[model samples]
Target: MEKVINETDDKIKQYNVCVSYFDTLQECSFSCCFPVNVKPPVIVSADILKFPRTEYICGENFALDGIEAKVCFSDNEFLLYNYGENEGLFSSDVTTLNKTGNNEVEIKIRNKYNNDGFKYILTVIVKENRLVSIDIGKNNEGDVYFRLGKQYTDKVFFDHFSVTKHFEYNKGMTHDIKNNVVFNFEKLQYLGNGSFTGVLYARYTENEKTYYGEYVCDASGNNRIILLTPLPVSLTTEKAESVNISNLAQKLKSANITYKVRYQDNTELTFTGDVFNNNTYSCNGVTYTINCNKNSIWLDWKADKMDCKETSLEAGKLYIEDFWYYGEEDLIKSVDFKNEKTLIFESENIIPEDLSSYFSATVEYITGCKITINGNQLNKSIDKENKLITVSYNGLKFQHSFSYSYSSNGD
Candidate 1:
């Protein structure tokens, strides 16, 4: 057995030669005991890999922030010749699977002395990087619908089944807008003087329940500039209205103020005609009742007529109201007042007066907020039930003024 090497040592060819008796070239056979390469290169993590054939790679998904695999080879003399993600990529000794799931890595090793080489398959599982942001794409109408859009930077992230968390529209069920999103009831209510300055109520699915936030929208050429609350909120949607404008109406002296909606062309539509009777108001030639979901602005219009026990049987009427909501998202529709005896409550306002001896008030909020009453806490009691707070010896029933702000993360 004889073995010879070429200059490059990359070619393996066999030739047969014999000296014929007639001085002509003829075929002859030769034998040799040449060493045959028997085994492939061994890798410590190779057993964890899938296919060992031409399709030598398989992968799974990971969501953890930091995870890495350590690969050790059988021999140190073998060269870590070339390793990369693709054909034209540069080779590096250390391969990284750090991105959100779009992954491929190649680890190629070869014998330093011969033409024998091996390609190792590396299955990288990087977590999918998910993105959540407020999106205001146009609706079926030319007007834009505010919605929350989830974007995936890499397609491999989806292929690896990295999307585990399912999304819900709003935990509070404020709207029917799909994809865990919220939108304005009006088309272009965000547009103001020179820019847009209005609040938007938005919901997304990172947590199980509905959430609320207020975003101030500004128009920039063709795009909207908005700021969302970074913290989380759990303000419960109150079944009964969370606002009591019966006392707030005292500030307005129960005035009959007209509510009007102005359009882009300076055209105005009136919502309230006669403040005493709230049947339905006409706007833009369309008639509507007081509703938060519709074009008619919802208000803190609260009026209650209680039977007062004075020297004579007289009616104690508290007729106080105003139109405080510009759009659906700007109103406070509900709140959770299960606990806290001193739970400060405020309403998103606009009210009408009813001289009847019955108590009825409704408050709805679109944005997330907390209500604070100034000094009028409920202290007056009727038998065991409280009616109003008594001020002086005269027993005057007057609720103090109130203000409101956004809710904190856990409040």
Candidate 2:
């Protein structure tokens, strides 16, 4: 009897089998029962004899034809060879060369008889012989842009170019064979993030000496790329503290009290009693007003304003929010001329002092400018590195700082 089985690394599982033999004289069939073993395919040995050359230049074909591998597999045949999370991410395995940055391709072999397979991973890093210059600027549509120069600096030694793009929303596309000086893209993104990246295949030639190659580049906020219009910051209550309306009445100065309330529905209501930001209100967007009227209080609704002597208000969704004019508070972490949302800048010193438990503001420096908190001077030291001026007074901590840079032309 002949035994049939595939050698693999899986736990040995018995596969029942039947074998038959024909008798010439009697013309009858005789059968014998046996067991075969089945498991996952095993990679006995493998050597990548030839792989595509590393650091390929732009505008030049990145040949994958040289990817020759000597793989000893327990499988019936090699089934798949592709690159990236989805195939044809930057360039095709069967058709083109490497266009993106460092990338890898996977080779899979499967045996149909025993249903076993082996996988091999190979890497390729490509580069071009061009200097990369990057900066933050604007695009044609007045949006903030990240500029990546692909042979734009060395335009005199050049010809047409090629580019490749991989986006966060989907697998990227290759924009090869373009006769332009600068390859323009909306944005540049890092891997696994929701953004876009462009690869340039630039060709430079002059005096019978031409340099041909490609390189991948990312914008430098040190891997932090900023966009013109990003999504809004969502409101969260995990860190919120509820507030009481009666506490707001303490800030009033009149016997017949009045208050301007910003309720939870994002609507405003005026009552003659008291109003303050609820401790549980969001810490970033609520506004509070306390007014003592002689006999009537000015009340603001969703759209209209009115005068009221005494009115009862059932508060709903009441919260406190403190924010500058620009945008969210957390995003404006590092206070500078570039990160301001509300306070105005340019030759003016403004103190963002609040009567509440906490206060924030920007401290502009002009070499000899003095800073004071609660009628007292602050420390003489300035953190030039962070461009921030620090101040704390009467149990209140404040970070007030902004550093300025001269215009490119020293304006």
Best by TM-score: 1
TM-score of 1: 0.25
**Candidate 1 lDDT score relative to the true structure:** 0.30
Off by over 4 Å in 2: 2-41, 58-63, 74-117, 129-411
Summarize candidate 2's per-residue lDDT along 289-368 as a digit string, tens digits: 32323322222222111111113321222222222211222212222212223322232232334312122333322211
Clash counts per candidate, in order, are 25, 26
Taken over the whole model, the C-alpha lDDT of each candidate is 0.30, 0.35
Off by over 4 Å in 1: 1-4, 7-11, 16-80, 83-116, 119-178, 184-199, 206-411
